[model samples]
Target: MIKKDVLFNEFLIRNATPEDAVQMEYVQQQCYPTLDPTELLNRNHFINHIKVFPEGQIVLERDGVIVGSASTFRCNFPTQESTFLESSDNLWITNAHVPDGEWMYGIDMGILPEYRGLGLSKEMYTVRQEICKELGLKGQLIAGMTIGYGKMKEKMTIQEYCYALEIKKFTDPTVTPQKKAGFRWIKPLYNHINDPEAGFACVFMYYPVDDNYKLECKL
Candidate 1:
C-alpha cells in the first residue's frame, strides 16, 4: 500500500547542501557528455551556490543516491536578446545573485542517462514553480539546451527548427519536454549551451508564476 508512482516510487527531491556537491558533480558528468563548462565547477562552485542562495540548489534522489540536479539563481533577467545561459552560470560563479531580483534563472538541469523517462525533470520544474510563488518571484527564465538541433542543422536553419518546435510541427528531446511542462518557446537562442554540434543554439523559454498548464508527467 505504499503511495508512490510504481516506476519511481522510491525517488525523492530535496534542497542541496554544500556537501552534496560531489554527488551532484557526478550526475553532471554522467548526464552531459558534451563537456559543458559547468562540469568544471565541482566543489567550489557548488559550495558557492549554496552559500549565496541555498534555495536555488536542488537534487533528485532515489534509494539514497543522487541521480539528477537543477541549479538556479535570482536575478534581473535581461530583456535584451544578447543575454543567454552562460551569463546565468557565471552569475552564480561570481556570487552575482541579485538580492530580491524578480526572476529565477535556471543555471543548469540534468538527469543521469538511466534515470531519464521517470518524470523526474517535470517534477523538478514543479519544485521550481512552487519556489517561485513562495519567493514572490515573477517567473522563470530558461535558456533551454538545443539537444535536438545538432541533428537537424543539416536539414534546416537553427531558426527554422526552433520555429517548427514552437508551432508543434516538431518535437525535441530537450525542449519538447520542458514545453509540455508549461514553458513556452520564446525564440531560438544563440550560444545558450556550449556545444558545437548544436551550433551553440538553444531555445529561450519561459514559465509564469500563474501558469495553469499541467504536464502529463504524473508523479
Candidate 2:
C-alpha cells in the first residue's frame, strides 16, 4: 500500500499540512510571478485549505523542502459551475467546499520554476485521481490557465488556441500538460482569472475516474 507518504525519485509526495502554508505561498509566488497579487493565495488561505479539506491539499517535497503543491475542494458538477474566484470563495475555499460533494474541483497547482519538467505534476494528478476512487467521487475538474496564450495572441484567438489544443494541432505550456496528464478539454473560460499571461482566459478540463489509463500506485 502507498501509505500517506510516497517516495519518487528522491521526492516526497504527501498530503499537505497547515504548517506548509509559508512554503506553499513562496512556491506559488515563484510559479506565477506574473499573476495578480490579489489573486495569489496567502498563508492564511493555505491554512484554510487544509482545515477545510485536508485530503484535497497535496504537496511535493525534495530534500524535506516543499517544491510543489496543489489545492482542491469537493463540489457537485453543473450545479457548481462558477468562476475561479467564486468557486474558490476568494481563496478562502471554505464556503464552497461541500463535505460530501461528488467531484473534486482543482483550484490551484504549482511547481517552482526551477523544478519544472521533472514529470512531478503527473504524480500530483495521479494522487487526485486516486483520491476520487477512495472517496467514491465522480472525478476531477479544473479551470486551467492558458499560459501560452499571451505570447500567441497575435497568432490566433483563445477559442482557436483551445480548439487547436484539443485536436493536437498545437500545445500550451499549461493546458497541454494537464491534457497529457489525462484531463480532457470541456470548454474555455474567459475572464476566469486576472491572469494577463494567460490572456485572462482558462480552459475547463475534466478527468473521469473510470478512464482507461491505469494508475501506477503499487497499492
Candidate 3:
C-alpha cells in the first residue's frame, strides 16, 4: 500500500499508463455514480488513447496510490460529442469553427472524494497548462457540467445556482477558486440532456498558458 502522507506531500502528476486503467475506471465510477455505463470509457479505451497520446491523459498519485485523474485531447469547438453533437464532425468544423491553426484541449478532471477541498484539482490544471505550453497550444477549453445532487436540489436553474453560489458559471465557478487558478468564462452553450436538474450545461471556459498566468492552490 502507498503511504498517505507521502502521497499527499508531492504532486505526482504524470501520463496514464496501461496499469492505471483499472484504478482510473474505479475512480470514475465512484466519482460519477449517475454517469451512464455506456458513456464511461472502459480501461481498454484509456489504454488505446494513452498509447496514441500519452501526454493527453494524466493521473495523480499520493505516494503510489492513484487519487485523481484528468485527460486532455486536441480538439476544437463543442469539445466532445457528449457535450455537443456537432463535435462528432470535427473534421468538417475544423476549417470553419477553428482559426487557421488554433487548437483547443478537451479536458475532464476529477479527484477522489477524500482528496477534494485540497489544491489537487488546481494542481491537475497546472500540469495541463504546462503541457499546453510545451505543446504550444493556444488555449485550454472545457465543457463544465452541473449535476444537482440530493443536497443541491433547490438550485434548479443555471442562473439560480450561479446566483446562490455567487459564481458566474455552473461547471467551474467564475470566482476565487477557479479564477485564481487562471481560468476565465467563455460562454454558456446548450444543455447535454433534456432534464434540467440532471442535465449538464455546456459552459465553455478557457485558460491561456501564457507567462502572465499563474497556477496556485487555494487549499
Best model number under lDDT: 2
Q: Considering lDDT, which of the candidate structures 2 and 3 is the better prediction for this target? A: 2
Candidate 3 residues 69-162, lDDT tens each? 7755665444334443334122122322333234455545777888777777777777777777666776576655544422354545555554
After superposition on all C-alphas, the RMSD of every candidate to the true structure, in Å, is 5.6, 5.0, 7.1
Q: Which parts of model 1 have CA positions greater than 4 angstroms off?
A: 1-9, 36-40, 82-86, 89-91, 212-219
Query: Please, what is the TM-score per model?
Result: 0.86, 0.91, 0.71
lDDT of each: 0.74, 0.85, 0.57
| Candidate that would win on TM-score | 2
Ten-residue region with minimum lDDT total, candidate 2: 210-219
Q: What's the ranking of the predictions by TM-score, best on top?
A: 2, 1, 3
List candidate 3 segments past 4 Å from native. Answer: 1-8, 77-101, 148-156, 159-177, 193-198, 211-219
Error of 3 at 67 (Å): 0.8
- Span of 10 residues, lowest total lDDT, candidate 3: 88-97
RMSD of 3: 7.1
Candidate 1 to native Cα RMSD, angstroms: 5.6
